[model samples]
Target: MTFSLRRMLYEDRYKLILAACQDIRRHREEVAKTVIASQLLDALDVDVPSDALLSHIVAESLLRRIDRNLLSGRNLYLQVEKRPQIDLFTLLQRAIPAVPQGYALANQYLVHAMRQSSTPTLLEIGIGKGLQVVALLRALARDPGKIERIRVIALDPNRTALTEGVAAIDEVRAELPFDIEIYPLVKLIEVCEDADYAHFEALAEGSLSINAAYTLHHTTGPDSDARTRLLRRLRALKPRVFTLVEPSSDHDTEHLTRRMHHCWQHFATVFDLVDRSDASPDEKFAIKEGFFGREVRDILGTSDAFRCERHETLESWLLRLKKSGFVPYPEIELDVDLPEYCRSSVSSGLVRLSYRSVPIIAVFAFAGEAG
Candidate 1:
């Protein structure tokens, strides 16, 4: 067979599987859905090393099928209260290095934003378990003379996350030479009102900084303007610097085929990194199934209204930040080590972390229009 013909055949198979999924979504013929499910399961039996992406798609489709039938006619994403899968999630994140690298890079600007102040306050959006905030506090503590006291206004929709994140931050407080105060807010960015911004502004004493790592994309709205509106509200708070880190994919799209393609391309790099990690096989399986697999399920399986993992491209984020009256805040390059296969680049005042040649995560800093 000619190479072109083989490529064409390969794409056709993927399209056929996707069409099967759409048919299941639209016309729920149990027999047809079962056949498609069986085909996907059989496809997973193939062990070609280069077919990892294809294998993951098949596996994800199977999970979505199970979710549809097993959830009593309700989408699982809507019904279940998601708890933090911390250990495996951290393992997967550490293995990839993109998340940690983004955290480190964002911390650089976050610390820089507060270096000159005697009293620094941070308004961290979606401060999940305070991982990044704890890291940022530690970085700030390195120069105890510059900063005497710090306050953190942590916001997250997950009550459990907010509670535990506050505890984690407090644990580090006793060890630091500076005084630490934390105010935890259990709220979503979409629903935060003017009172919330006023409260945040009132909390500031000297310098204020904002950091949203792997957050903000979760802000779902009735329309696309939800994120922009939230950013505008945040801009009004007038933090010295705002740093954001988000996945470099467009899974927020309503089109399933496009979402599937983007998810496959983006997660393939992530899963490949997990596969290469020195982690135990069971650990990797847990990370892939428990952490990343759930993300895949939410993206591909749930209804548009119920879906929460709304990721977008770096370009789209830049446009939204500009629309909300933000200008790029530059950072000094750090001398941090990365995995041999990973690469980092700084361009247009944005730092992009990539696996092989595909960009996976983007980190950038911006200031409000006045600043």
Candidate 2:
């Protein structure tokens, strides 16, 4: 059998690095011991070492920037090599260096919201491998007496993701004495109309706590009424609390140049932080390229359906929410006690953080009027 290699575009370079990072992070020891193939090195546009460290390959790739095609995701490592592909959800878990800190922040809000409920019901959108579920359950585990049982409605388009997420939250059942039940809804919010949300809203059983982490931006255009319509849809759920987590950037412009600049400025700050993180060079590359890098492509590459990654700050999100009948929940700091992983990821940097230094992700808690 003969196989032909796919030609990679310059825009695919960062994506290639993302693939390389995911692969190396998954097989660190193997990469450290062997002389990786010339084909691999050429594929990544990096030099080959006699005994190569994946970290070294990642560092070398970062030295150069892609010149053409701007940003594209194509012929990804798994696609080219036919390797056991990394699940985007699981890879995101491993690739995002600061996600734990972000998750911890969201978990605190989950605890606060659930503590107020008679029977806590959490509706998490973008249930990617159940990362948010883990955070919510962990927070509940910390305060077992707050609620007797928690019902989670996890929504995503992928059934595999539902399976993975259900399995993850199921573990919390063993840790907490309270009954934990997870209902996975396989649907994408992008296509859903106001009435479509009724299905999940019906399952709320009572006052609901809705959590949409990094998922709302994809639901509609930044300036479109669709944004408000979407907000109204969630508001109609009569949520007791809504936990929102989004990137702290405004990449919603129509101008290609403006989008490109915002994309650069945003990821530049992020990549700089990744460079400073105590994570190994390979892990840093993966976080930057595999995880955040894909975001850069999403913002710059296309504006087609669901390819929309329109990010807006907390202030911007609030503007829409307030217009749509959602009001602020009682303000709670809920400062995350950043674990060593987070501390290390943000550590070893000498740059004094000024206006340029900002949190990559922000968490907000809000609520809408009851029906």
Candidate 3:
């Protein structure tokens, strides 16, 4: 009897999703389609649907609203751990135009902060493959005389990524005119103790700048107070500047349906950009499936404790920053030219990267003061 009831619930969800897909197709207006999509996703979240049905909803219905090729052969349960490749990360960074643009904006802010001192120390959280650091090094190299030497403290949980990132920075250091030193730590920021932070603070010697790009969202959990406490600790550092780069979406909710809706909206723009990129079809598949598909799976398919991609909105981030004793830094402009598909806007303490009016990524710089 229990098995029969479970089967009935699954079948009902599958049928409801199918009907929602049809309704979405009939609706010509984007707002109407979005409403239907959100409602449908919310209802389906009550009882989890099958992987195949979820894939169909995404490939056939959700992505249709984005004006892109239908995602094919996608599984909701696809495991990202089995396929950890730096190549995929590289492809994602290159294929998405907003990515490099975000990196450039972040580098611009970091370089500006570095200029305040002759020997500045940078402790980058989630220093994945050191892509942003490498870019920052190149930017600093262009005007070498302003700074004498630079020290980079690279931190991330992935040992392989830490190894690759340090090596990349070292290679760039060889070409740059200034002396560069790298201290790579294989640990998550959430787990760092007072001693670890003391070591970090001592290394900076008062000239500290912090950068956490697309990786701080993972530090959001283990508990509710986690992000708050982490931010407080960062405030305690009293760094010269703290730069954060994150996707501007609200998937950090207990409501699975709302989470799914936000996830769909956010990744739709990302996947659409991937489709439009100059990358080959196979490369596109790899990115959408191997890179982003995993993130989608984690957001919708996993429990909150297990979900690492708990992205929040720009508003939530600002509130947290304020509560943690950080105000928006004065310079909030991206003087560098951006891609045609991407446009930037400055708010109180945030710089948003949007795709056709949808907020995609946000770069926030903060000083130790509540505004």
Candidate 4:
């Protein structure tokens, strides 16, 4: 079946199952398990609804081995080894447009910086699931003829993330035909402090540019000595452009009104678009309350380091580039449109009650000519 047709059918199935779930007299756990299975199927783009029966059987079998009561509680994670493949990748892709406007702007500036430079090599730090890397690859793939010998390097401490990303790339390799080369560097062989200029020199010897998405925050806290050590190393590498993207909201503030507003808007949209009338209000609420809000809050709340640093701000980061001997350029804006579901999340107080704030910016810098 074609993708469009499959999507329509899946939508109908989702609605049907949701309707079934609303009947409290029915086995709620069974309904929930079936619905979760269906969602996984939809995400995988599997054309066969019959396949979902197998998934349900698998879920039932797994639940039976764990505990009969557990199945009724709708704990699908215990039964599933992997996240629904569709949700995993789709979630990552969804983040692209949600990237704060600043990040996109920085990317444009980096592009301009690369055009002016004699050589352009791209590097991405913290290559999580390769969503951003894929985004970059997609762009390069579009103009394969224009780019000559593009070398993309991704660095991460997690072997699984890199491995999974490489696997994902391999899966799409045929569809995204590009000559651009991607190098996955899964190990940070040495700590930044212990490393000397020679270490950075070796890393940047060939790369003319570098970009990091949500990685720098993980590397060090704003006040930690590690931050300076990492910064010195970054400066030493002397890439033409160094860019970072992080949550734009202020971390110090527990109450972020604007972000809260956005979250509320997001939740409402999700309920309106994704929830079905057949689904019990409780089931729909659980999906929204237990799944979406909890997950986002956990992600955004874990780090104050990204937000605490002055450089986390787009303007401050640009200024730092100049201070670090890189000529600063006018800021560019990424302007990611938050999904309506995200907007709706605000009213739920997930941002204020859970995350404490909302992320809001992207920052970039360009190196000054080598002295």
| lDDT winner | 1
Cα lDDT of model 1 by residue, 38-105, tens digit: 43322222133323434444544544644445323432232223345665567777578888889998
Tell me the whole-model lDDT of each prediction, alpha carbons only: 0.74, 0.58, 0.71, 0.44
Q: Model 4 over residues 178-214: C-alpha lDDT tens digits? A: 4455678766523534443354455445556767765
Worst 10 residues of 4 by lDDT: 347-356
Highest TM-score model number: 1
- Measured on C-alpha atoms, candidate 2 has an lDDT of 0.58
Which regions of candidate 3 fall more than 4 Å away from where they truly are? 1-54, 57-85, 369-371
So what's the TM-score on candidate 1? 0.84
The regions of model 4 sitting more than 4 angstroms off are 1-97, 100-107, 115-119, 144-146, 170-179, 188-190, 193-200, 203-207, 252-326, 330-359, 368-371
Taking all chains together, each candidate's TM-score versus the true structure is 0.84, 0.69, 0.78, 0.49
Arranged by TM-score with the best first, the candidates are 1, 3, 2, 4
- How do the residues 1-371 of candidate 2 rate in per-residue lDDT, one tens digit apiece? 11132321222333334443344435552442232222233333212221122322333332222222211332334312221223433444443445555666666766877777657788888887776688667667777555877788888877886788888887667787577777777888767765657766776776588888777887764446777777788887888887777776677765443444345445655555555556665455555555654565566544434456788755577688788888767656545454343432121101011123454666666677732
lDDT per residue as tens, model 3, 187-284: 99998999999998899988888998888887755667678778989988887788888888888987644555566567666766776778876666
